[model samples]
Target: MNRADETGLAARQGAASILTAVLKERRAFDDAFIAEAASGHLRNAEPRDRAFARAITATALRRLGTIDHILSLLIDKELPKRAGATENILRAGLAEILFLRVAAHAAVGMNVEAASRDENARHFKALVNAVLRRATREGDAILDNLDTERLDTPDWLWQSWSAAYGEETARAIVRMHYADPPLDISVKRAEERMTIAEALGATVLPSGTLRLEDAGRIEDLPGFDDGAWWVQDAAAALPAKLLGDVTGREVLDLCAAPGGKTAELAAAGAHVTALDRSRPRLDRLEQNLSRLGLEAKTVVADATAYAPGRTWDLILLDAPCSSTGTARRHPDVPHLKSPADRDKLAALQARLLAHAATLLAPGGTLVYCTCSLEPEEGVRQVEAFLAAHPAFRRQPVGVEDVAGLGEIVTGEGDLRTLPCHLAALGGLDGFYAARLTRAS
Candidate 1:
């Protein structure tokens, strides 16, 4: 094989490995797969190859339910037990043939080549070729009859969103996830948003987030190393803004690792103390801060256990949850999380919320947010918190607070942004945030 073909082959092989990791080994597609690219599956590949590998892997995971369904239709009978990478190889190839729009010949040829060479799957090389080729020819007809959104999304998530947001809206959310999420940048200097966006050919959203379409290789963009802006979802950026004008006020950022919110707090001139349990993630936050020329005191401790020995003027507890809201960007969410996991996270969030409440000064504001579409983690979580802690009451988010995105403002006046909320502006993450105030 020539150099280009070799890279292509590696990318396909790498995609299969990623699928195997997510599907069989049950590792997070981002944390275990892409984050470890240099030392993991794509280690030997070039940057372009790694990107291609990621695209293929993400496509497969996003459409695995339908891909598996189509594969079942194509196969006459099940293959031998312990089929090695056969399923992944088939999945990666079919994703290319169907969703990714890769040329049929290349997608089929490379994956067939992979199967023919692997000792475990060599016996099924012909089967792989037959299945993918037929998919290229007959896939459309089959897909025309398939409810892809229903097929692609997990049952528990579907039912949960349906119960929370209504069945029609839940379907809309799943349909939106079919498209890749747009990149959103949060600028340090709020007034400079338009100038910075124009320089980068990006548009300013109603929420003041800079939305960029087709932004390739984020670091390669202007103002990256200089840290003029950091990548944050438009919806994810809202909660920080809810804690407005932090100028010189003391603020506690609970569960603030990989700190976009910390950066916002620091940039807005809060005497910020960012806390999280994961030292490595906090190290990343520190590096990002160093790049942005932002400053914040860092604490490595669990939000549920940490004791600051003093109260703060404001607190932002972006508690940990299923992160289902980010499904458009992180396709592994539906495959990885479950109701049990949501329950587990909800329990943790409750504890963290309770602990954070104790650390807030009387008459202080605490903004609790989660990138979860699940109600148990959002409205319900805060509702229970307020009921138990009579000292704190719902301050209620305002239409103006979310930069005039009134469609996302809930009836109770919290922020409940769906992934499909701003579809005309390339959709945002499904985020929920409630502002609560403690009485003096």
Candidate 2:
């Protein structure tokens, strides 16, 4: 086969693998990508081909609900239970033609060819071509008339977000997830923000984050190797900043794997001990710290069980959640997470919060946060924690704490950032954080 044909086949195969991992194995896209890359499925492809595969997978997953909705209109009967792979091929094709704006003829042809290569799917090649061709002709009109917010969001998630943030805000958040998020970077020194922004033609946020329209190949960017900055979302950067001046203080970062916040605390001159349960994820955090020329004592232990031998002056627990807030970047998150998972995570967060309170010194601050839009994981978690621990009191974040993100602060003084909060300047992940202090 020629180079172009080989590249197309590789991309389609990669997309199919990603879809199967997500739909059948229930794997997160990031984990699936890592698995694919480690298996040489992606490693063998050219850099451009690898990128295309990734884009196709993300696009297909992100718009899967809408694509499926359109596909159902074209199909005469329900797809067979065993036709998952064939269905994914059709989804990929529709994604390319409808969302990615690829030429319909090429998109349909490539996907049909992809289907023909599989014995199980070969029999469905005609079906794939027919459905996709009909999609190309009528999909846009169907999509235009569909209630995308309802179709794209899972019923449980839609109900939860809508009940919490209201219908209008929930719709806005769902719409924002359809587009790729911009890259936000946190610099080692605030003084260097302007210089780096100028170099990359990026915008500097009020919170000192450098925002790039598109940060392709982050390692290739200037100052990346020099340890001048690190990639962090504007919303993700807030929890550490809420601590306010951790210099010389003993800081504990719980569940701090992939430690952007750990680097933030260490860079702020705090003596930080970053702890996580996953050794592999901690390894990545250590690599990030090394690249940034920063230091933090790393521990591979569960946050609830670790004993630091001393009470921390400041503690940041970036607890795990459904991570629906990051759907914009991950795309597969909305498909992979379920309401039951959120409930289980909320229970864990409550335990972690209670445990973290015990580790904080009298008069020291503890920040509880989650990359979740769910109240059970964020607002209610903190409220319940306060009720259970009489010694701890809400610190109430002020306008000065988040800089430009003052609008997202709740009346009760917690930070609740939504994907729609900074809509005009791209958007932010839905994050909730509450700063609490123990009475001395």
Once fitted onto the true fold, the runs of candidate 2 whose alpha carbons sit more than 4 angstroms away are 37-43, 82-84
Question: Which has the greatest lDDT?
Answer: 1
Candidate 2 lDDT over 103-221, as tens digits, reads: 88878888888888876788899999999898888888888899877888889989999999899999999889988899999999878889988988898877788899867899999
Local accuracy by lDDT, each model: 0.90, 0.88
Off by over 4 Å in 1: 39-41
| Clash count for each candidate, listed in order shown | 0, 0
- For each of the candidates, the C-alpha root-mean-square deviation to the true structure, in angstroms, is 1.4, 1.5
